[model samples]
Target chain A: MSTEIDKSKVVLYSYWRSSCSWRVRIALAYKKIKYEYHAIHLLKDGGQQKTDEYAHINPMKAIPALIIDGHIIGQSLAIMEYLEEYRPENPLLPKDLYARAIVRQMMQIIGSDIQPLQNLKVLQTVAEFTGQEEKKAEWAKRWIANGFNGLEKLLEKHSGQFCYGDQVSFADLCLPAQVYNANRFNVDMSHYPLIQKINKHLATIPEFIEALPSNQPDAEVQC
Target chain B: MSTEIDKSKVVLYSYWRSSCSWRVRIALAYKKIKYEYHAIHLLKDGGQQKTDEYAHINPMKAIPALIIDGHIIGQSLAIMEYLEEYRPENPLLPKDLYARAIVRQMMQIIGSDIQPLQNLKVLQTVAEFTGQEEKKAEWAKRWIANGFNGLEKLLEKHSGQFCYGDQVSFADLCLPAQVYNANRFNVDMSHYPLIQKINKHLATIPEFIEALPSNQPDAEVQC
Candidate 1:
């Protein structure tokens, strides 16, 4: 018999400071699309996203749910693809099918492999279970580094100013968000020169600058 | 400064019992795509996937790297999309723009949200950190139920014989693999009748049965 576990709490999440959220934001900025941003305080009021109000806006009860023309779309990658599908003005994926798969491969390294493991909730759960609350940062650092190691190898062949080519595509959008996350967790990037170099290069792009957590209206003031 | 963390072990994983691998397998089977299955043996010989041989094939060192015509594709969802793009025969996604986004959204609820948390490496890491090896099953169940809760609700509006309408889209391919995982973790499914119903129906199909973990060539002998 299975014990009743928590239901209705979904985390295909988009948080104010979440890397996944930044992934969508950067892509949107690259496309030069303007949209209003809402601050769903994840830590305040026991998470505004958990409320019944937010659930109606998004049955999944996740942050970063995009409301386009009264239709709501959840999941960061899905939103990215949707924008690519409908807008097609500023394409984010490569033209070749195989090349597109390559771009997505790198994005998933950050999206699925890294982001989920370092999620704030998952880290809290780990800390509680481990009885070492301070280890949350360590958990985030470890997972980020693991994914970056593979990513560094991946970019060796794919890089030329951006992931998979000179153009700003899906991989470029994902890398900055990951690097921002890696910096938050204080992941040492000396071992990953390519990643560090590419991230530094990306940070200079105006679109990337616009999407940084520090630039967001809802960003917390850090000392 | 971030402490030295484990690196280079990527999880473009395709282990015999892994949930993501099964998703791609079911989709591949559904398309009547015949391909060779190579068992990289995740646990044997100190993880064959970690070796230089496998890295050449996929530097990510993950399992189920699908090599077609000398072009290797990694990531389960990426592989599935690649199939849909290249094959276009027996489509797995809806034709409508918003509908495609919807299909991909559910896949992420499982792929990015659930599967990553319940990954064997992640679970093992949690067990090691928490020193509660037995609680691993509880952890797995908790995440599965959490994702399924939202998934069940999403299905109320979209489901027919499968996850979305009558046609087997990307969401249907991802559902059974997660359901198989839920069963192993003993997640309570009473609240998720739609999911339960869809999975029950999907299992009866020969393609899904052929892709089940127990039927894999590398599967260990059952008592």
Candidate 2:
């Protein structure tokens, strides 16, 4: 069933290097939803997210906000689930409720567990508290290791060709961006073969490749 | 339709003072699902969550794990969503997709934004880094204030009687538990009248009232 909402008018407020933004971008691509990418430099002039224009789009002053037919949706996980609901032709979730729960669990591991610990503000706090740049990196590495260890164990039980199974759900969309961030911080994925394997497979997907931070035009100029 | 699964056979591995566990407790009460609560002392014996048995239940070594028909589900948000799926009669999400997205966003704000910052590990890290109890509390207060400010703004727009209008969603299950933790740390809620109001409303509810940390069987007994 086609949604009554107009498809051509959809726009995504995103930052090139934000993993959360990349999750939504991958979801849009997977669902074949055509959307205009409106880049918002998160670090420019004390962050464009705090600006009036962006705040009007998302009161929370966060990235990965979706504007569909004038209605705004914030939060990357929420946006991906919304896309799955509106555009069900190319489904992102599994048919069974149990399977869907497993997929959502995977999303939560990244969305809730990993991403928040390494967020910009948390990094800043780590720097302030420790008064050492190396200590901040260590803090980031610690949380990443903790989250990835749990993820690796969970993936051991359920992973097939992807994080959930053979099909690519929202979990697949999350893994690449997180793996990319981890790589930047020099996280040792060699201990997590399943994660490394999934990352390798996701890298070959056109949707994942196109959504890479380096692929964005604004990423070239580095704000 | 009554699920074939027996509610009485359910067992919840929880910690009385843990906000995450309290979230699951509220969900169980809301659904009227019968279950035995097995308390895990988060602080005692150097965190009982790291014990062999608890690790078997949840490799993540987190509290608020639900064991149903021999299968285990971890993460408070995921557990509540799973409950809503199986016990759809007491729905925690709205019928409309947009409405559901709003509910999920509220959950995200608590699950991702607020809860993690003040969690045990983060708090301990702050104390370790600062080498002062007062400074750690200050760190806690700062993040909580930032999160609550954003939450209050979002609540102003969406709240009616609860976090997302009249009917309680998964968001309600999360907010009270989190707010309770913030209150324990003496983070004043005077600024967020909407949150304070909702906190009062939630407190009066039988399910929420019964799920309080003070009301737990393990409350008086030191871990």
Candidate 3:
């Protein structure tokens, strides 16, 4: 039975080095899904993300909003989970409920607990609280170090080849992205040996390699 | 054929007025799952959650860690999603792909974007940046107001009786919890007509009412 093809392609509104967008890109590549990449520069021209045009796409005005069939979905975790539910192939989460919970737990540790504290917008607002212009990279490193300390301890037992076990899961997807940001902030990776180790291994995977910030169409030579 | 009753009991390590904990409570009540509640005070004796015992339970040392059959799961989003997957009944998330993505999106908006910025630990760390012990509730109100402004616009189109629609999903589970915190922070809910309306309505529901922080065993009479 020939079914209707989805002509409305998946368009990812992403910033080149965005950890969230990198996670989604890895998920898409792992699922072997095709997508059109739209680079929405996060820092150029007072952040293209803050423009009225992007706000119409995501009122949150965040990058990594996945547009499919004209329906836009924001939030990286949501976008990745949507792909899992929509395709259910090349599963990013484990089959067992308990195991999947652990994967989700690890992802949330980074996603909810860690990354939000280090977000671009959140960092941009840090000067208001500091009563002076704070170093953006310093703010990022502070939060990343704090969160990664907790994450490193959590990964002690659960981590095998990846965050959970032998197979790559959602935790693996989230780790690389956060690690990318960690490197950018000059966070001491030595403090998180396991995280650094797992991140090192994930870099070798084809999916992770393809989704690297340097591999993106919007990749820029950083000074 | 009669199904065997599961012998393993569910135990939740939670704190009263913890928005993340409240979210998991609502999901458990909505699922009608019998569970033991262990109150892990977030702000007592230098924060009980920072204790060694709680650290053993959840390495991340966060609240709302579900212990079932000797296995533990931390993070409210993970716990709620675990409930959805473990039982797959009384679904808090819609089964349809697009619908579920939006629910998760709204949940992430509240879970990742809003609440983390206002978390007890995050607020406690504000002194590091500000050089003075800041007003905790004031800080909470600031981030809540910023996030709600964006959320209000998103709800303008999607909201019906709930954040998504008439049917209560994970978005519904998340909204009430964050709204509960919003009240504590004295965030002006009047600015968010749709959010205020939905929150008021959610109060009438048994699940939400039962999950109220005031109804919990550890609830203290606020002076």
Estimate candidate 1's alpha-carbon lDDT, on a 0 to 1 scale: 0.80
DockQ-based ranking? 3, 1, 2
Q: Which stretches of candidate 2 lie over 4 Å from their true place?
A: A1-8, A221-223, B1-8, B221-223
lDDT, candidate 1, B73-97, per-residue tens: 7788888888889888888988989
**How does candidate 3 fare on TM-score?**
0.93
Task: Please state the interface RMSD for every predicted structure, separated by commas.
Answer: 1.0, 1.4, 1.4
DockQ of predicted model 3:
0.66
Clashing pairs in 2: none
In candidate 2, what are the lDDT values of residues A1-223, reduced to their tens digit? Answer: 1224334588888889898998888888888878788888888889888876666667678888898855778888888888898889778888877777777877888888789888887898888877876777777777788888888988999899888889899888899878877887888889889999989998999988888877776685532
Pick the DockQ winner: 3
What TM-score goes with each of the models? 0.91, 0.93, 0.93
Residue B149's lDDT within candidate 1 is 82
Question: Between the candidate structures 1 and 3, which one is better when assessed by lDDT?
Answer: 3
Q: What order do you get sorting by TM-score, best first?
A: 2, 3, 1
Tens-place lDDT digits, model 2, residues B1-223 = 1224334469888878888889889989988898887888889899988876666667678887887755678877878878888888878888988888888877887888778878888888877776766766777777777778777887888899998889888888888876766777788879889988998899999999888888887896542
DockQ values per model: 0.63, 0.57, 0.66
The lDDT values for all models are 0.80, 0.81, 0.84
lDDT tens digits, residue span B1-223, model 3: 0123232678888898888899999999988888988898888788888877677677787888888755788899999999898778888887678888888988898999999998888887676666667556767788888788878887887878988877898888888878877887788888999999998899899999888888999999741
- Ordered by lDDT, highest first, the candidates read 3, 2, 1
